[model samples]
Target: MSSTLSRVRAAYARVEAVGRPEIWIDLRPREETEAEARAIDERVAAGERLPLAGRLFAAKGNIDVRGLPTTAGCPAYAYEPAADAPVVARLRAAGALVLGTTNLDQFATGLVGTRSPYGAVRNAIDPSRISGGSSSGSAVAVALGIVDFALGTDTAGSGRIPAAFNGIVGLKPTRGLVPTAGVVPACASIDCVTVFARTLAEAEQALSHAAAGPEHALPPLPRRRPGPWRVAVPPIGQLGELDEGWVAAYEAAVARLTAAGASVRTLDLTPFTEAAAMLYEGAFVAERYTAVGPFVDKLISSGGEGLDPTVAGIITRARDIPAHRLFADQERLADLRARALAELSDADALLLPTAPGHPTLAEVAADPLGANARLGRFTNSTNLFDLAAVAVPAGEVNGLPFGVMLIGPAFTDERLAAIARSLEPRVRLAVLGAHLTGQPLNSQLLAQGAVLDGTTTTAPAYRFHALRTDPPKPGLVHVGGGGAAIETEVWTLPAEGLGRLLASLPRPMTLGTVELADGTTAAGFLCEPDALTDAEDITRYGGWRAFLAGAEDSAPSGVRGTARSAPTHPHAPLGDHPTDE
Candidate 1:
């Protein structure tokens, strides 16, 4: 066998031996695979090296791959395509070989993997849990090391949620970053082609290749920026409902950032959550019907029987929405886009949980729609606001993997990726409040490559303050010797990543010594004293999260607090471009 074929076979063998999660469908025949590899061998022999030489990849069955049948999860919906999708053609031309088409939720409707007629994709790390979906097979394929990367689509977090569950990197680029010319429509205006891989570098590489060039031709170079980074995270209380395991995981990630020297601060996520709810609960749902309603209705009329009941039900509901309602949803989405940009205005990127929680397969089966909605809680708003996102595994929770997502405005794919590469290795971190793992900003840490260490407490002498910003900001200050030990955690990061992280800090927020109860100092977030004059001291509750919980019942208006006057502290400077070192 040729070298490329042998490598692909070996990788496939490993996956088969381990009985890895569902990863392939409609695989290329061995002869075809061999012939493709031989073509690459010939090119190399001719001294023509391709950017993705001999790499193996997979495509979600919904995307067209020339000569392959595109089954969008329904046998009746299958069709043979004569041409490759623009993105697929780009990858193939770069010397990548297609291994097979991966499975997904029927028509890419659900986040839980069970909706597929092809059998539910099990979590790569645990068989009992559900792999996040509709990119289920794509995520598992990479997590199992069966392929270098895979293509999936994200209309409402199908691409990202699965990546979080499978312990891999899932890149959901800005809506149009990668051409969707050949992809089956889910919600045409918001659909995005996504990439999945074992590492951020690999996923980013694939994303850059797919998104290269002008709107039509593949560009010669990838848009990349290097150096210091500023990442905004959701303040406490705004993190949404999260299980304890996720909370611990998130806190640990934040601590890792402090140790790495990257500044982690809280921002308001109200606008994001507001926007996210609109995707499914508002007129956006009708877009799905607009794309395939006729086909579905025809199938129903013809007595066709393969459609997933849930998917059919969702599409049928879309028909109930009126034209005016659709227009109103569009206007609301526009308003949210403006608000989201303002909320995320200061930082280089926004960090949040990839999902609020991980439910078991049984739990999902019992309440598929509800469970699926929860999985997309943090992801749905991304495409609506035209943001780029990357979901990376944070660590495990009770033997199941946990993940976080990093989000940035349109075309900020490279910037979010650079930050994810830095955070990947630092799994364990300690946080005192709302930014904990599984929390809103936890995704920020996960995207940066952090893993959860564990949960603990801090020494009593320090005080935690909640700054009055829209989403809320936290300031940890070292008080004189009389304080009580506060609860905390510790996360570890690669030594090389810390420097790049430290340089991204905004003013007033600085990395400094945080005394633990054991007389040990760990890297934790601290702010300048001058900035705390108007801040609310919530040290008695020990963390910003606890304070927010108590105040939740009496929560003030969404527009209650004024944005803090541009930071006066010299240490936490902002405005450094991602392209600047």
Candidate 2:
């Protein structure tokens, strides 16, 4: 959408109306913004289908944009990048113009939006409240609608927490899905280029375009399949203390999900919380030292001001971590990662408040480290565990915004995107046999943008047979009275994804309406009666997994089976049943 030079002028007018220069460390002149907008219009006229054409976005100071010094919210460390970060280049190419580089916590440390020397990024709705950082300015820019969306980095909840505080959508893609080629590394190993948008679709589109570029150390993302979305919530006891208003809002949020045909399950918060602690309390702090230690040392030795005291202290202490301690922490992290995957194996995603609560600027100043650590309670484990997360606004609490985050194992980015979409269009599908989590064919479902909603069973009206296929498959046939309830998982996908999934299905397997244990019916897998003629009746095992476990027991230890007992990664130490971890 463009209006010659008029629309760009209007956008700048809105920028001035908000009048929060402190929110941005380096905002381009109105003339420059207009020029860029006009340029985008010219490109559109040239028939470019730039998904982000005519849109304005802000980049976190940590991310490079040519012509502007990347301050990373630290003036002492500012430097002009030779070119835009790959992610930014992709967005700009897609027709989105940059408004300016926004502020952040110095060196991308601290979750409090207040750590920046440019000035503490005030909350958009209430200036006295914290904006949530280190993506503070980027989130506020979108929160105030100053920009259509913004690019933020998520090392330890910098992206999602800010979105929660500002009441917007923050999509933190699978760790390496979005290129971080030009981002200032907070923790290079886990730093991710994240997107903040007024809507989930906007963020998803930006993600799609940005992730298409070449990347370094790209990791595999799980292909998701469709079914009922099962969301896991931490028990009240694990949520820790929050204001009465926030607690009420959280409960209401869960109730809303439950009422929306979603099955909400309780999860043990121990593993997640423990892993989160590792981000700062464990050897992971060494990562921060590795990223900025040289600069910090130079600053100190040269008599220049160093990082915000708290951040400086954290990195400084990292030097004391012995080599063996780093190895020990890695081992600890491996165990935690496995346990986390096991915890999430049964459900489509984990749902939690984006942050424990919103702290006031005054509160953060008084206890920066403590307050900031609380903000990352739900987000710190995401990157460490290599998962995808999206933060969605839920409602307000005591006049400040509250939000919930949906987190899933890696490669669930698209599925999480669909789930986070407002009024999302989707179709529910029940999946039995190989498409289940950790199964060999599960990728087929994921490739079609399917998400595992949750585990369930067919209403004692279906019989399962082990077919004699080369790779092994299950055949489910509806039986009148002698059938048994068979374990199955429900997955959900975009309506369009269903066709792709069906097209990929081989013969003997077809889509059919199946009754679930919950009295609901969904399009699911079914087999032609004739296909079961020579198949073995495995219905007595109740589910494909049970049969696999039985087969494994009869076979020698360490012998592999059709179903994966655990993820292939060495970090995952799960058993045959992922949920059993």
Candidate 3:
């Protein structure tokens, strides 16, 4: 079989194994999708350079996929679309085959997946929990690994909440970055075409392909700082009644960002919360009525056969919102946007829990509207303020996935991606002695393809010691009180490389997270408490290089530790260590 054929077959098998029938509302026939993939393989064989060649994707039901009927989760409301939506067409043109159209909340109205006639889309990780909505199925499909990436729409958290629930990456580009021409808009002004995938790079890749449609590109926001990025996080009190576990998960994610080299500042999230309320409470919701008030009214009058009661209530209620009230809401939103923007003026992005909490199916069933509203706490205001966002899985809580989102002002999509990339699995190593430049073990790091990030010092809470080894080595130990800052170098490499380096590590030295003077932490060398028993305390020397220099100055001419005067190598004046010492 051809590569595309093989991949398509494997995907079909995985889809069947997942057994979540609600994930897809409309599936293109297996033969038809395979035919499309086969054509792409043929084109590649004929020398085409399709970026998404052989990749598979699913479009949310609200998004037209040419062959599938656009059902915004209500059969009576669905229609035969004349063509693929602009975003969908772009991905297809890039050689991505559409697997089908996925289920979602009716008319993309609620953040809870239960608001769908097709069926409630259950969480991929915990079936008894809500999967989030209105981009519900698209997020789960990606999370389940059924598709390489999937398309969803974001307007008041539809895109991000689902990704958070499913433990995947959901990237919401600037409002107009990806055209929504053929989508059944929840609110035209706020609707954004988004992509969900298993990694930041995959989501970014899909956005790059989808955004290249018919000239919708905008200038990206410039980075804020020249050194380590600055990220703002909301104060815990402002996060509502978030579960302790979720809050701890959010804090841990922020710490990871800090440990990966970001300066974090506590931010007041009041402006953001106030703006988010306007999405469903203020006249801004009138846009939903404007989008499909007539059809919903027709259904309501005929006993609302196809309309979700909650969705109908929300849409119908906004029908009589005075035009002046909308203008007032717009003005208020402008004020909040100004405040939120000011708070983020010097930061690359704002990081927060993707949702205040994860609700189980029973909780959502008992209080659908309330549960849905809570899920949008950190997501709704994003579109209202015209910000770009990327939601990513941030470890798990109680075996269920937890997530954090990075939100930035409009046109900061690329910058958000860069910040999110820090959350990936790469590891940073802090080398204090043997692994420093010009040192004996420096070759091992270079051999593993590690790159020297920069030179720095440990926090003033570590003691430096000289281990009594064949070739003396230094050991770093955390001493809560009487420690002093010690010189060190930080190097970055893939996680696999770090594991390989650890495999051959000698006795007395082990790896642990080292606190740096700048408040960041990195994996570095440390000695066992027992190894410190007979080790010489070299704390006063401040560093191995300085101690070696002092020893050379006072030693006899033939002393083993003695070396010629520092070499002309400008990279290291004193030389962290002599290669043969």
Best by lDDT: 3
Q: Model 3: runs farther than 4 Å from truth?
A: 220-225, 427-581
lDDT tens string, model 2, 450-563?
556776778888888898776688888898699878877777765645765565566777888999887999988887777888899988888888788875223221212333
As for lDDT, the candidate ahead, 1 or 2, is: 2
Best first by lDDT, ranked: 3, 2, 1
Compared with the true structure, what per-residue lDDT tens digits does model 1 show for residues 1-581?
45565666666686678775455657777778778878886886687756666568899989999988998887889899989999999988877888888888888888998887778888888878898889888888777767778999999999989898887788988777789988899999989999997767567666767877867332243433554466788876888799678988987766665566666778878888888888889988998898888888898888858888888888888988999998998898899889889977767778777899988899999998898887777888998888888887777788777888889877777667767755666323345643454443443333233445555567667766776554466777888686544556455543322443456555566777776655666776677888789888776765555566775323221122322211111111011111010
lDDT of 3 by residue, 469-557 (tens): 76788888899799888877787755645775676566667878999878999988887888878889988787778777765223111
> Number of clashing residue pairs in every model?
41, 17, 0
Runs in model 1 with CA error above 4 Å? 20-22, 216-228, 426-581
Q: Could you tell me which residue pairs clash in candidate 3?
A: none
Model 3: number of backbone collisions: 0
TM-score of each: 0.71, 0.71, 0.75
Winner by TM-score between candidate 3 and candidate 2: 3
Judged by TM-score, which candidate is best? 3
Model 1 / residue 287 / CA error / Å: 0.7
With candidate 2 superimposed using the best TM-score fit, by how many Å does residue 573's alpha carbon deviate from the native? 46
